[model samples]
Target: EFFYENIQGGDFSQTKSFPGLSEHSSNFTLYYETDVWGARLSTVYRSDYITDGDGVSSDADEIGFHATTNVDFSAFYQVNENLKVTLEGINLTNVAEEQYNDSADRIYNVTTSGRTFYLGASYKF
Candidate 1:
């Protein structure tokens, strides 16, 4: 169990409709790795913003889960004892909607990136 809170920037207005923004975020991750394959499970949650001085309020909340799996195909491979290649993957679960905010009179949310791949090569000479 874990928890945290933070304050976000905001603007205030009398006729243009403005509100203060703040957010709280929390998450948990369980990971496991092995010689051939590995997996990780994670969950994230967030709270709506609390208006600073404005009376209005917004409805923006966030909650999501992600799972990632990796494979070490080169665990027992050799390329003539000279050069070897390795491949990797990131954000395999393709989680989305990682951010959210609700305050004053507006609500917004966004997701950055998901499901990426990486490749690497090494030589011993």
Candidate 2:
């Protein structure tokens, strides 16, 4: 499946919306499941947006600001009718962004947790 969002900037009372504010974003997912096994994968893509109170331009008009993409994966297994196990991985590609830091006056790479994994089990009463 796919999802999308669009955000517009405007003036509300005396407060103006931020420049970047993630004007557009999309998400996609693919999943499959069976009696014994299941798997799911998802990806997120976002358009370049402005930073609030950072005085930075949108990704289209400036350097340092840019769009981003990330991916995640998950799987599960059913050992029996009453029990199951699941495994998940987040940010599998370690996607990150580079932005201009006005204070530092240089381009810096912003990173997330990189890659992480989780294992869990469930039982039915």
Candidate 3:
């Protein structure tokens, strides 16, 4: 399944719109399953967007975020009717979070999060 969004920017009295209003954003997923096994891979993406449109004269508020993408994956194997094992990986690529000033120059702030993984089992009576 794939989810997509394309929205018009807001129109303030004196400006085009507010910040963080992206024209395009999407999430795509791929999956496969069998009687005893299942797996899925997905990605989330967002286009560059302004953070504040109150004033575009000299500078804007919050600024704009650069285009970003994140990937994740998961899989599971059924051991029995009520038992299963699962594995998952999040932010597989460790995409960083970045924001720039209105001018699209000079970094405002950049954050990073390492990839994560999980392994577990479940049972039901």
Candidate 4:
């Protein structure tokens, strides 16, 4: 549900950290359910860190993630006792997955997958 740590250690040559290791990351979730209705919502978050690197150097095009967040949701409803319907969605905020040169302002690359959704039904015997 939550996490916090300072991943500050890397190759003996430097006192920094490895690639793709973000510090201070966390997750939170909420849920509700009833005899005929159920729903859930969740959010995941990660703090900024030295995301990555092409070649080990101070200005050698370092990569880092700018503290991004993602939200998702799902819900279900029971029809009678033998049928049910469901719905779900992802990336509700559409927060593009991004890459920067150390800081967030210095945008190096940007990409967005757009929001996604799904619907379905099931029957039980």
Candidate 5:
């Protein structure tokens, strides 16, 4: 499966930041799934984008934000009619990007649990 989206907004302001906004942005995602050897595997990829800020001071407007492609993988296995095993990996690439704070005049990297893995088992009665 595949998906795409676009977002548009007018000029806006924040509590402590410049009066500007990302006029246009977009996102895309792809997903795939299949069954093999009684086990199921799934994968997903996503892309993000953001237009540069506008209507702000020249100094603050210089800052920008964007994201690299991100991927995730997962698998599930049936141990028995009443039991199952599962595994998942998130942010497999440790994707991250820098964000600029106009008011603070600072830049910092933002991320969400970069590159994580999980495993578990479940039983049904």
Candidate 6:
């Protein structure tokens, strides 16, 4: 259990304070791997944000949620028992647009980011 608070920035007539918003997020991760391959899984849930004062928030506080999972598929081979090679793929699920925002007491929330994938190879001697 945790908490967070934020204030906007800009000219709001008398003062430059954005709406104060708070969010709570919880997450967990699990990992599994073998000589041939390995993988990791994780997820995060964020609670809705509430506005502190009226007419102060650029975007009204709203409920938000996000999650992500990654897996790496690798193959290893030994050359003369001295050299080896491995291949990996990061962020297999490629989750995108996970964040949500409430824009001034609206019914819908805004989302941010998108899924991404990456690959690489390595050699050991």
> Comparing candidate 1 with candidate 3, which one achieves the higher lDDT?
3
Each prediction's RMSD over C-alphas, in Å, is 9.7, 8.6, 7.3, 6.2, 9.4, 7.5
Clashes of each: 0, 2, 3, 0, 0, 7
lDDT of 6 by residue, 1-125 (tens): 22223534434322222233334557666666665555666655444444333333465433333333333343343433444454444444454434434433344434433344444445555
For model 1, how does the per-residue alpha-carbon lDDT over 30-65 read when each residue is reduced to its tens digit? 665655344455555444433333322333322222
Residues 18-94, candidate 2, lDDT per residue (tens digit)? 45666678999999999999999999998765353323333322223567888999999999999999999998988
TM-score of each: 0.38, 0.66, 0.76, 0.75, 0.52, 0.41
Cα displacement (angstroms), candidate 5, residue 116, comes to: 1.1
Tell me, by TM-score, which candidate is best.
Answer: 3
Per-residue CA lDDT of model 5 for 1-125, tens digit only, reads: 11111212334433222223333434444444444213333333323222333424544533445435556677777767778788887777777765664434366457566788899888998
Model 2 pairs whose backbones collide? 20-49, 20-50
Against the correct fold, how does model 1 do in TM-score?
Answer: 0.38
Candidate 3 Cα deviation (angstroms), residue 5: 28
Off by over 4 Å in 4: 1-14, 54-61, 102-105
Tell me the spans in candidate 6 whose CA falls farther than 4 Å from its real position: 1-23, 50-104, 107-109
Task: List lDDT for all candidates, in order.
Answer: 0.40, 0.67, 0.76, 0.73, 0.50, 0.42
Q: Which sequence of candidate numbers ranks them by lDDT, best first?
A: 3, 4, 2, 5, 6, 1
lDDT (C-alpha) at residue 19 in model 3:
59
lDDT by residue (tens digit), candidate 4, 29-96: 99999999999999999877665443334544356767789999999999889999999999999989
What local lDDT does model 6 show for residue 65?
A: 30
Superposed model 5: Cα runs more than 4 Å off: 1-58, 100-112
What TM-score should be assigned to candidate 2? 0.66
Give the per-residue Cα lDDT of candidate 3 at 50: 72
| Candidate 3, 1-125: lDDT as tens digits | 11212222334233433456677899999999998999999999988787654444444433677888999999999999999999999999999888886554668899898899999999998
Please give the lDDT score at residue 61 for candidate 4: 39
